[model samples]
Target: MKTPVIHLDVDRLIQRIALFALAGLLTIGLSVLGFHHWQMSDPYVRAVLEIEGDVSHGRAIFQMNCAGCHGDSGDGLVGPSLHSISAHKTRASLIRQVIGGQTPPMPQFQPSPETMADLLEYLETL
Candidate 1:
């Protein structure tokens, strides 16, 4: 008895692979362009886009207000570590939490939207 041999078309396989690669590249390029357009068009995102966050100012604010409890590097002294807070919480939630002053044993501080935005940006850096 003789075994059957299968012959594969290498050219066809290469063409299919190239087609898939091109499609993937096109999809990613369009997605990036669309996101750029959305950022420029959306009012809320645009506002943040126009105004660059001041890391230095945010550091000052953090040092003055948050360092005592959160520690200098936000490593958690009395309060929880803020270095990874952004990983667990959204910017809006963090801002609201800070403004609402719901954290027990921590003093409540009233900060303007701009200040809170700066603080949130700073916290994200941590």
Candidate 2:
């Protein structure tokens, strides 16, 4: 009786590993680039970031638009408390959240770039 033999190609195995590593690195690099581009592509984001904000004006805007849900002081009513919100969310993230309204019961808010900047400034104080 003859025993069966198996062969392994060491060079081929090394090539495969290297190819996979290269592919993984390319994927990560592309993802990072794409994210950065996506953030910069929004005109509102760019405009808001460029302008300085007015906290008083922002407070007024909040009182008019958000007080019903978020409370006059942003202490949370129907909506969640905004205290320390800046600590948890980045400015850009806050912008997206306000505009996206992905969460149920929270309507999408499309403020102008200057108004958004003002709101962001006020949120930081909460």
Best by lDDT: 2
Off by over 4 Å in 1: 1-52
TM-score per model over all chains: 0.58, 0.72
Against the true structure, candidate 1 reaches a TM-score of: 0.58
**What lDDT tens digits, residue by residue, belong to model 2 across residues 44-80?**
8888989999999999989988889999999999999
lDDT on C-alpha atoms for all candidate structures: 0.76, 0.91
For candidate 2, the lDDT comes to 0.91
Model 2 spans with C-alpha error above 4 angstroms: 1-36
